[model samples]
Target: MSSSAFRTVPASADVVIVGGGVMGVSTAFHLAEAGVRNIVVVERGELGCGSSGKPIGGVRAQFSDPLNIELGNRSLRAYRDFPHRPGADIRLDTVGYLFLLDSDRQVSDFAAGVELQNGLGVPSRVISPDEAGRLCPYVSTDGLVAAVYSPADGHARPGLVVQGYARAAAHAGVTIATHTAVCGIDTAGDRITGVHTDQGRIACSTVICAAGAWSARIGDMVGVDLPVRPVRRQLAFTAPLTPPAPRIPFTIDFSSTAYFHNSDDGLLFGLADPDQEEGFDTTWTPHWLELFRTAARHRAPALADMRTVGGWAGLYEVTPDHNALIGRSAELPGFLYATGFSGHGFLQAPAVGEVMRDLYLEREPFTDISPLGADRFRHGAEIRPEAHVV
Candidate 1:
């Protein structure tokens, strides 16, 4: 498919997908592979311009809950096979994931999480701090009590993954309309009638909101409450090391929400700011590096003084419970959503695409996602809080 194909929005489509990040393109690929035709993906900007464009894409199945573990596990397999199936080299590095724990409570919680993950076919295990240091030399065993390591989990290139899925989907005849902002969604009673974009009106029978940080507005267009809020997460890349950094696991100091991993000849440092306010702003604040440096000073002292060349900031489509929303709208059956993934959207995109495809076809998905429905919030229900978030 030529670049011009992605520029032209058609008059109508059988299904209209909002957002062209990893989720949207993945969904389009799955649906197209399943023989669904006349599909159109509408992106406000170029593909992967949203959260999906972030560097340091970590793929892991080390979660406290089974749902997240399953999603991550399934997606790991897909990412591992991406080069063969979707036919793209996403620079997948299976250096593994190491979560550093400080408190006894963190140890116990992670132990339980490891048990659950193991039951679900993930080879995650709790190890001593000494073992953690062996896996990643930079990790200090000072205050660390225990750590969790999963060899199957790692990181990949999000942009390449997006392009891979997008190209495959477009080649299968799915229309990908970039630079097309969705002005509004047209609905009649309990069904999606069409999607109105700045380019034109696309008469679609179904509308899928994979809009990530902007999903709440997309839900409002159809009278559905997605309850998604955007929070800025930032990370910095260190200058190229003189001797090149050692390949290490995607390591995280779980207690402080600070993390670091290998990136090219340097390293990437990130920390979730506890005081960060909710917004769509993605301006990379270099001062935020102080938070990670502070944590690293205590956890991994060597990383605190690393020279940072530049950084990237992106939004995490956060939900109250910090889990993903994946299901069809009860009120508007024609409307489906796969958003509010917090920071795990890129890692879980592949499985989510398959889930959304099965959902649209009214077929049973590989795993039951009933618990992830948007209606959970309306009914005063929330899934268990997922630990191991970085």
Candidate 2:
């Protein structure tokens, strides 16, 4: 069907991903590489042009949930070996993440997580304030008692990573049709039928709701309500200073509620605004800038002298539990979800795809993904992660 057509034509497939962000593209890439070629990825806008584009590129294994810990660990390996796969040369910067611990309880809790991560083969370790400064001297170690540092964790170019997945999926015979918005879903006898898109109706046996911020609306199309809500996050960067300090590691200042990493030529930074921040709105305000400045001055006094370049707002599809709702949706069979990631979607994409394919196609995954099931939420089983430095 052509874009000029008034009516959307129908195309058949095994799966239809509704969003073209890293979550959707990465899943398509993994599934296609695993031999599931009958897939169609429909995006409402250009590839990697959503929350994925605005992510501060903070990747770490500092998670409370064991599932997320395992997932992030696996994704790290994939990023390291991404170039081995044809066309997935997304440059993932493994610069490590240093999270400052402001309170004793916070320090003790993170120490426990560090112990758990290390036991699970993740090289996460707890360090003192001096050690934090040793890791990055730019940090203000005044009130910082301890910090969690994981050299194995890092950040990648979000847009390039999404493009890598989309391209890889395309090369593997998976159709990536961007700028093709999926308006609603078609359903039949207790199962998914097809997807109604701007281009045409794509008929698919399995419908994977990878539409990040729009997952709830997509779920409603099939008469099921997904408890996913979009929370707005604004990110920005400063002009480059003289000779970069070996690309500073992803830093999280717990006291300031701030986190930042690299931005190609400049230092990307962001913080939550106490006065104005939340809900589906992605608008940026001058007060938000003021809050970010307060954080920068407290964490890195040097940044106070730097000039603000620009920034943008993106949404985090947060679930009630702050964990992603993966696996099949029991309310709608043949309908799977890869949404409600809060903000961990990009880092968890590769592992998520692997697990999703293993569950949907192979019938059994290596690990138990039952915790991520939507039913778990209703059952009061939460997979709340430890790394809450959003």
Candidate 3:
């Protein structure tokens, strides 16, 4: 099968993934490796053309929940093992991540999150504000009481990771439809039998809805309302300064809302929006710059001189609890739900893909998916909220 084969022919399959982001491609690849062919992945746009292509490239295991810790750890392993590629390697830089202690409550919760990450084999620890400055010489440590530092935390290029998964899936004979969009679901009785798409209809027994920001919309098509909504996140880039500032780590100021890192040519930066708290809008405004500037000054005053070269907005598939909602949907049989990743989708994609594969192929899940299942929401189960949800 060639790259353009799907464009020339209308094909059917045993499984159809309804969003071609990192989740869809990663699942398709692993599923193929599990010996289940006839897999078709449909994307509303080109692969990695969604938020997968627009991430700030953050990867870390510093979460309060053990499930997320496991997910982050599992995905980090895969990233560590990704075969070396020339040109644009997904630079896995372990420059460390420090979540600055903001308040007493923030400090207490970070202690718990660090303990959880450590229990799950993550090398995260609590560090004094001075230690935070040691890791990133440019960081402003004034009034910063303490920090939660994860030395194992780092970042990888989003486009490279997406392409790696897509290439591996294609090499394994998985049908990856780049420009296809799943319009709706074709159901008979209580089970899904096929998928309705703009290109044509696809006959399949199992369907995985990995459609990130559009997850809620996809759920509506199948009568399963996924509580996933897109919250716009803006990232700004700066031109390289002289001497490169000694390879800074990905630092987050819990005291403030600032986060910054060293990119290839320059540095990448992001901050929380002061407005809405959460929403599904990708529209950008000047207010975001204010938020970034205010946070940056409180965290690292040196960054105040850095002028923004440009910025782009990406939607975070956020849930009510700010954690990913993964598992089977009860309303729609033979259909599984895997979205509402909040902002952890990219880092957790590899593990989430395996979780989906295990559920679909009847293999033992790497970890328990019961906690993340949609049934929890139906039964009024609460997802444990993490204070360090960056």
Best by lDDT: 1
lDDT of 1: 0.91
TM-score of each: 0.98, 0.93, 0.94
Better of 1 and 2 by lDDT: 1
Give the alpha carbon lDDT tens digit for every residue of 292-379 in model 3. Answer: 7877777788887687677778788877778777888776768886888877889998889889999997778989878887666678
Give the alpha carbon lDDT tens digit for every residue of 177-274 in model 1: 88889999888888788889888899988999999999999999888999999999999999999888888999989989999999998999998998
- Worst 10 contiguous positions by lDDT, candidate 2: 1-10
Residue runs of model 3 more than 4 Å from their true location after superposition? 1-9, 84-88, 277-280
Query: Can you give the lDDT of residue 239 in candidate 3?
Result: 78
- After TM-score superposition, the amount by which residue 37's alpha carbon in candidate 3 deviates from its true location, in angstroms, is 0.7
> Can you tell me which runs of candidate 1 are displaced by over 4 Å?
3-8
Model 2 lDDT per residue over 339-368, tens place: 888888888888888887876785777578
**Cα-based lDDT for every prediction:** 0.91, 0.77, 0.79
